[model samples]
Target: MAKVAIVMGSDSDMPIMKKAAEFLDQMGIDFEMTIISAHREPDIFFEWAKGAKDRGVKVIIAGAGKAAHLPGMCAALFPMPVIGIPMKTSDLGGVDSLYSIVQMPSGIPVATVAINGGLNAGILAAKILATSDEKLLEKLEAYSEEMKQSVVEKAEKLDKVGYKDYE
Candidate 1:
């Protein structure tokens, strides 16, 4: 199975992007991370995408805000899947980033998550990899069950004490 590659447009996005790294770590998925800006470091982005397949990378998780082109660029250059996380910037609250990521050309598609939704991007990447990995599939199933149990437990607490009282 191919490992995931986590790329961000800037170091400023690391705070949001770290959630994806944490998720990958928890799920025991191997990943590589780097800051490769599509605008500032175009050559590096192209090089990374061109060699990603040979480097055994199966998916790419890219996070950027405003004119977010990293994900789309990577997807266009690489055959593997690319998950885009739109970071919530100060100006447009990340709507600009979302549109840039989601409005790909007909041939290229970047799977995009909500603004500042790096966690979901990580989980989706796990899901994509799990299609060909039995171990990852098992882990994902367990994770889903755990999430369900957590919600149920929270609801039970809310019922016993009432929502306001619990808080």
Candidate 2:
């Protein structure tokens, strides 16, 4: 069974949603990806959200642009964590999407990432899962160390060759 479910309102959201899927893949986490629009296909959306828990989905990442209610609605239906990725839209520069997902009412809350922040959402999902899975915790710790090392390497190179010429 998949541990994570990545959903989007449209195929256009795939470029962003793919980042989350890639991260989950790197973490050796199983996930399912699909397109489900809350507005266009309400019944299908409802069924997918309702059956997610039984399908062994521990976390959900939903990406939507304008009027981004997919994540919020998924949170309403699922008891587990739902991370909302606000895609950059042609209008309002995605602020609209960001606000729509983040402004859920009391009791129902969705963890929101920045606009086009699917990668961060994926990392957060991994961290959430790590809280209970020791193996995942180890992988996360190692990944963190690797990132720190990359930064250190970059800094060393910058020190060797000043910022003006630095690539």
Candidate 3:
């Protein structure tokens, strides 16, 4: 039973969506990933979204370009946190997808990330789950510390080498 479901409308989204999977994996979060187009195959998509909760999926990270309905649809049917990753499209550079996701109507809400922000979507889902799990929350804290340490190290190196000579 996966705690997270990472779905995308097209396989083309795999590159961006996989960042979410990788981050989830790093956080020791179990996740199931799949490609299901809401437009081309509404029946399958509907079934998957409707049954996700029953299948033990607590969070959904949906990536889609263009109209980007996958995340909103999951929000409508799953009754859980749905994070949307707006893919960069050739047409409008993903502004269309981003708007479609971020501008949800009253009740139904899909928490959206920046364009191609797969890693952030995964982190957000983990944080949402952490709210109920102390162990997970501790892990998230450690993760934050690691990130802070990384930046500190980089800043130290920049200070030592100076910005002009820093790698």
lDDT of each: 0.92, 0.96, 0.95
lDDT of 2 by residue, 9-86 (tens): 999999999999999999999999999999999999999999999999999999999999999999999999999999
- For model 1, state the Cα shift of residue 108 in Å: 0.3
Candidate 2 achieves a global lDDT of 0.96
Please write out the lDDT profile of model 3 over residues 1-167, one tens digit for every residue. Answer: 99999999999999899999998999899999999999999999999999999999999999999999988999999988999999999999999999999999999999999999999999999999999999999999999999999999999999899989998
Residue range 33-135, candidate 1, lDDT tens digits:
9998889878878998899999999999999889998899899999989999988989998999999999999989999999999899999999999999999
- Following a full C-alpha superposition, what root-mean-square deviation does model 3 have from the true structure? 0.7
Candidate 2 Cα RMSD after full superposition onto the native fold (Å): 0.7
User: Where does candidate 1 stray beyond 4 Å?
Assistant: none
Candidate 1 lDDT for residue 63: 94
Clashing pairs for model 2 are none
What ranking of all candidate models by TM-score puts the best one first?
Answer: 2, 3, 1
